[model samples]
Structure formats: C-alpha cells, structure tokens
Target: MIDKRCSDTELVSLYQTGNEAAFEMLLHRHKSRVYTAIYLIVKDRYEAEDLLQDTFIKAINTIKAGRYNEEGKFLPWVCRIAHNLAIDHFRKRKRYPEVTLEDGSQLFDSMRFAEESYEDKQMFRDTRSRMRDLIKELPDEQKQVLIMRHYLQMTFQEIAERTEVSINTALGRMRYALINLRKKMIKNNIAYDENFYPKRFDQVSIPRGQQGPDERD
Candidate 1:
C-alpha cells in the first residue's frame, strides 16, 4: 500500500513514475474539498457528483498526458478545475433551458441540451449507476463517515463527535473511502461521462518516462 503520509509532491512524483496507487492517494486526499466546492456551486447532489468525476478525469488525463505541472499544489489545481467546471455548468444551464446528459452532452450528435427524458440521455443513468455500485464496496466505517458527512451534511467535528473518533480519524476514513471507490471505478473503466472531453487532454500522448516540466504547474 502507498503511504498515506506522503506529501503531494512525493505522491505526484510517484504517480509520474507510473504508480496508479500514488494517484489514488492524491485523489483520496483531495476529493472531499473538490466535491464540496462543486456542490456549493451547483447545489444539486447528482450534478455535483457528475462534476466531481469530471474534475478527476481532467486531472488524471492531464497527468497521464504529461501536461500536469503542479509545484506541490495538487489540491488547488483540482479545486480550480471543479470550480471552473461548475461555473461552466451554470452558464450552460442558463444559456440553454434544456438538459443535456451528464458532462452536459446532448445525444443528438450535439453537445447542446436535449429534450427532457430523452432516451439518448441513457448514459447519465449509467454514470450514476456505476458510482452507486462502487460506493457499495466501501468499508463500513468509511461508509458511515461518507453518509454522515455528505448525505447528512455533517461537519468533520460533528462526524467525529457522533462516531466517537478523532477528527483526523474520521477524515482519514473518508479519504480511504474515496480511494477505494476510485480504485473500483478505474478497474471498471467507469466515468461520469461517456463522451470524450472537449479539452485536448486526451490528444496529447506522452509516455511516462518522457514526462517533464514544460511550464510552472
């Protein structure tokens, strides 16, 4: 198992060296804040989760493409991704009065909004279903923390008090829960959106050993 204590820099270095576990650690460490940030903006549980997965996919694809440049500030970068995506989501909703599938892709061979309850939006159901499946695999303690925090809207202190664990311990369980869930997702090739991202993160093909800093992250 990768050490949970590794700094962001160390973890990134390991991830750059082709360690997916290291990336899982990074995801675990940062997921809650990213989820919370998106939820605060979108104010919907399902859409917030959809954006959360997009943000992670963006970061992961960027890292794999060797475009990730973070001078030890991974969390901020992801949080920014989440914030920007959330803003984009709001703009799209305002600009277009219809609903697209998850990641806001309409199935009429267009990225625009689709008719309500359209069959083409089936991909969104797949996305949510996949996430639900992985969430079921979380350990009992971590599941409690996740439900109380995300579902019950409890703060860390409140969760700790209710669970009779230290705040750090409660936080740790949540982190592990995220990591475990993500591991299952990756294993199953799950994504919140079936469509490829608009960004060029997918087009860049850099091998692991060839990745080097091209700009300040």
Candidate 2:
C-alpha cells in the first residue's frame, strides 16, 4: 500500500512504476488546487470540472510516455497544463467570459476571500482585471518568470529548473518584473496597498525586505 505520508515525488515515482494507487494519492492531494486554478480562469463549475479531468489525463499520458521530467515539481507542471487549457478555452471562444457573482463566490472560496463585503468583492474583481491587463503588457520573459513565481507560487529553484535558467536569472527576471509592474501600477493609478489590492498582488508589485543572509535571491 502506498503510504499517505509519501511526498509527491515519491508518489510520482511509484505511479511511473505502474502502481496506480500512487497516482490516486497524488490526485487526491493536489486536485483542489488544480481545480481552483481551472475554476479561476473558466469561471464555470461544469466546464472547470471537465478541464480538471483533462488536465489529469494529459498528465497521466505524459507520465506514461516517460516524458514527464518535472520530477518533484509535479503540481506546478500540472497547474500550468490546466492554466493553458483554460486560456485555450477562452481563446477558442474569442472573448473572456463574464464572471458572475456566483462564479466569483466560488473563486473567493478557493482564494479565502468569501467573507468580504459586497463592495470589497467588487474592488477585488476590478483589481484582478486591471492587474491581468498590466501583467499582459510586460515583456515575455519577465512575465513568464512573474507568473511562475507569483501565480504558480514556484520557488526560484523550481522556476529555474522549469525555465532552464540559472536561479540568479530567475531572480533577476522576477526583480525586473516587479519593478516594471510597480511602474505600471502607479502610472495606471492602481493602488497596491492592502485596501485596494489583494495581499498576493501586493507581493508581486513590492519586493519583500531581505529577511536574512541565507535568504535566496
């Protein structure tokens, strides 16, 4: 039997060895985050559910084909697949879907924003929209690093591995991404304070202070 406490990498190894239960454990562990990532973009429960299944199927296929080289970084890899599929859904439709309050409620639930007042919800939506636009305006490498770091919440090591760059390059791209985003935020009059932006957005626009000598760049 697969131990429940096994790390994702271990489970992935077991699955690749033809132990199906290991894959089930991996799915149970990460399905919530993966689904949330899909729901945030598609904003439709049924559609998100479909895409979530597709995401895992694609993952399973890649693993079976021995093409999944992400190793310990499985979640980010799968999440990127889900994100791409969600974006493709919109691309095929030729327009972004309008998010309703109901859809927003589900998104807020996943994001822990469900308790805010109606006004705060509206502000959150607007802020997210504006931030997306600003992010799209960024240069490709900077934007890619920013999304992996901020959106995928990947560590510099993981980002470096995924992007095939040195850790320093990943850090440099993030620094420039934040600098450019801050400039865009100010020029567009989008407040980065807690009152106007989510804490996540604040992190993207403002670099945190150096915590210690051991802190990674």
Candidate 3:
C-alpha cells in the first residue's frame, strides 16, 4: 500500500521512480484546494474540472521532462499554474471582468524572519494536520478568497474580477476569512504562529528540488 503519510517531496520521488500511485496520492491529497483555486477563477464547475485536468497534464509533462523543481513547495507552485491558465482562458474569450488596479503592487504583508519558522522542525505532520482541521471548517467562498489572496498574492481587484464580485465584496470575504481563521485557532487553542502559515505562500525564491509541485501538487 502507498504510504499516504508521505511528504509531497517523497511522493514526487516515488512517482519519478515509476510509482503511479504516488502521483494519485498526491492528487487526492491536494485536489480540493487546487480545484477550489481554479473554480474561483472559472466560476463554472465543468470548466473548472476541465482546467484542473489540463493543469495536471501540464504538471505531468513537466515531471516527465525532469524539469519540475519546486520540491517541498508543491501546492503554491501548481496553484500558480492553474491561476495563469484560467486567466489565459478568460483573456482568450474576452470575458475577463475589469479591475481598477494595474499598478502591480503586492497585496499581502510580507512575513519577515520566515526563514526561522521550521529551522528546528522535523516534520509537517503537526502543521499540515492542524491546517486541514482548520480549513475544512471554513465556508467554500471564504476558503477561496483566502487561497487567492495569500497563496497567489492576488490583488483585491483581480480577486473581485475572478470571483464576479465587487472589490469591496472580495475584501469583505477576506476579512471574514481571517476572522473565521482566528476563531478556529482560538477555539482549537492553536497558537497563531506568524511564520507557520505564510511560509506556505512564499514566492519562488527558495531553492527548489528536482520535483516540482505541478498544478495540483
């Protein structure tokens, strides 16, 4: 049996060694957030599903090419690909909603000292498990807003366009998301670690491995 507890990096290694189940496990594990990310942009279940497949296909191609290199950083990398593809589709159809911001400034607060977050850590077991617990409780829209804003660094305008809501509404959803997250953390007594979560949304500056986190990794 495939060890479902394997780290994403470990799963990628196994997949590269001809273990097809490893890729399946990786897909099963991350499908929700990945699909959610795409769904938010496409806003149609069927189209999102198709885009999801296309995203994974691109990811698999990258893996086969032996150029995949995001390593432990899987979800964010693939999520980016999905987001880009969705944007391209909108552009091609000329169906993209207009947004007010084009200055290209970042919308998130950068986490300083993030490098020390897991310096002494041995595993993601505790962190990922806790995150799953918190995430599952969030409403779908709130979850989508949070994912795009933090992980993708999506501007509020872009989020509003993709979600088919006004900018204020997108901002409101993000507000509620943080409120819900805080409530969940307090309810579960999960101490707020500034670095623990934000590090997951980091950009591609960190050194990468030979296995990349594709569209759904």
Give a tens-digit lDDT track for model 2, residues 1-217: 8776687788888998999999998898788777755654454567779999999999999998989898677887888788667656665654433322221221212222213345534644676667766776777668667766665556898768766779999899999999999999999998856565323211212245845543443
- TM-score-wise, the better of 2 and 3 is 3
User: In candidate 3, which residue pairs get closer than 3 Å at backbone N, Cα or C atoms, i.e. clash?
Assistant: 68-212
Give stretches of model 3 more than 4 Å off. 100-145, 150-217
Whole-model Cα lDDT per candidate?
Answer: 0.64, 0.69, 0.67
- List model 1 lDDT by residue over 1-217, tens digit each: 8876677878888998999899887777667667755543353568878998998899888887888897876765776577557657766666433433334432112112223234324544665645654664666667657755653345788768756789999999999998898888889998655365332211234567777663223
Q: Tell me the lDDT of model 2 at 151.
A: 56
Per-prediction TM-score: 0.44, 0.50, 0.53
Off by over 4 Å in 1: 95-217
Name the weakest run of 10 consecutive residues (lDDT summed) in model 1.
105-114
**Residue 205 lDDT in candidate 2:** 26
lDDT, candidate 3, at 76: 64
Candidate 3 lDDT by residue in tens digits, 1-217: 7875578888878888899999998887777678766654554567779989998988888887888899676676778778777766665555424331233221111111112224223334585556644754677667667868864656788779876789999999889988999888888878866666543322333345644554223
Clashing pairs in 1: 69-217
Clashes of each: 1, 0, 1
Q: Candidate 2 clashing pairs?
A: none
**Among these predicted structures, which one has the highest TM-score?**
3
